[model samples]
Target: MSDDVRDSLIPYDEIVQDALRAVVGRVLSQIVGYDSLPGEHHFYITFKTQAVGVDIPAHLIAKFPDEMTIVLQNRFWDLKVEQDHFSVGLSFNQTPSILTIPYASITAFVDPSVDFGLQFQVSDDDDTQPEPHDEADNDRPEVISEDGSNVVTVDFGKKR
Candidate 1:
């Protein structure tokens, strides 16, 4: 392997990122089709709160200024998936709210039931990393274990 790397004309990283985001959309779309999560499958989707195309309540944005994670296991409704985003009704602090989240805003998606997860690179629109914030703690979801055998994390750092 050569240490000296050249910049490629094709934006391979962006392409792969888009494809992976599509996976999230496709998965949610399938769930919408069935109108229920199959077996023990569930999802914990984390996204940038202030990202473009994200339509969340003001209180939620205030609580999670940087990022927030939403669980889609139980106690959720009106799940809808679109070409670039998805919306779902969830209760936070006993208040029901509908959040529209763009796939590009998602940083992580995990199905703890199967110990499967995917971490995505942030979009070009945002250059800063998300600051640590308190957990949403909206729904009392089952705890995820420490095992990470099925997690896929792709980082397009500088090539050496």
Candidate 2:
């Protein structure tokens, strides 16, 4: 048998990405009515700042031109999750900002409280152009897994 694998007609990568993004939506949906997070469960959501359908303040766009990670912990409000996107209110440098992000713009999601994480490949054709951005320092502790049990990473780039 040859070592060639046939290209799939079905867009499995897009399908799987959509499904995984749904997981994020579902999780957020469950907590929309809650007053607070249950027992230390919080989320670190990272997304492309310049992705189409993403809306943020001009200051934030200038600071995080390529990507930004937001912590959904204390002091977050107005979290509205829809079929294709989510919007929330967060504070940055003592300034309040409202951000709306499409699920397709998300590149990573992590709940370090449970050592669970998901990483996605940003599509090259998604109209994302990198620009100069201020390097915001993130001090979250890294959760390392030796057994490789609770992390999901998907890469759909075709091999030559």
Candidate 3:
């Protein structure tokens, strides 16, 4: 085999990313259909706050300027799932707010009860650049385990 490499015309990386994001949509749809999370199952969805199509309160954007992780647990309501995005009502400091997040903006999803997780690459939106945030500074509950038991991470490198 030669060391030379060639780029394919198909955008396989983007296709696979879309497919994985659909998994998150399907799972959220099931929860919405049931009207609640099953048993102890819940989700920790981390997304880029500045991503396009993300509609969050100004306060939240101020607090989490780069990225934010929301826990879909006991207090969330109005769980609406769309083909490419989801909207849900949550409270921050006793103030209720509704957030709409596009699937493309999501960087991570996890269900700690089952130790399941999925990590995605940031979408290629030339208009917006994602800012990095330190995980140590985040206040959300830890969802990914260190044992690496059931977590699924998908990484498709840039197409050359």
State which candidate has the highest TM-score: 2
Task: Report the lDDT tens digits of candidate 2 across residue range 11-128.
Answer: 9999998999898999889888564678899888888987899999998878787888888877788889999999998878888888999999998888878988887877866555
**lDDT score of residue 100 within candidate 3:** 100
Candidate 3 residue-wise lDDT, 1-160, digit = tens: 4335456677888898899999999989887845457789878899988889999999888878888998886777889999999999888888888999999999999988888998898856573666655542335666677887887677876535
Clashes of each: 0, 0, 0
TM-scores across all candidates? Answer: 0.84, 0.86, 0.84
Candidate 1 stretches greater than 4 Å from native = 1-5, 33-36, 124-127, 138-148, 158-160
TM-score of 1: 0.84
lDDT of 3: 0.83
Point out the higher-scoring one by TM-score: 1 or 3: 1
Reference-based lDDT, each prediction: 0.82, 0.81, 0.83
Residue 114, model 1, lDDT: 84
Give the per-residue lDDT digits (tens) of candidate 1, residues 1-160: 4434566878988898899999999989888845457789878898888889999999999989988888887678889999999999888889999999999999888887888888887855546766766667843343444565887776787455
In candidate 2, where is summed lDDT lowest over 10 consecutive residues? 137-146
How well does candidate 2 score on lDDT at residue 46? 85
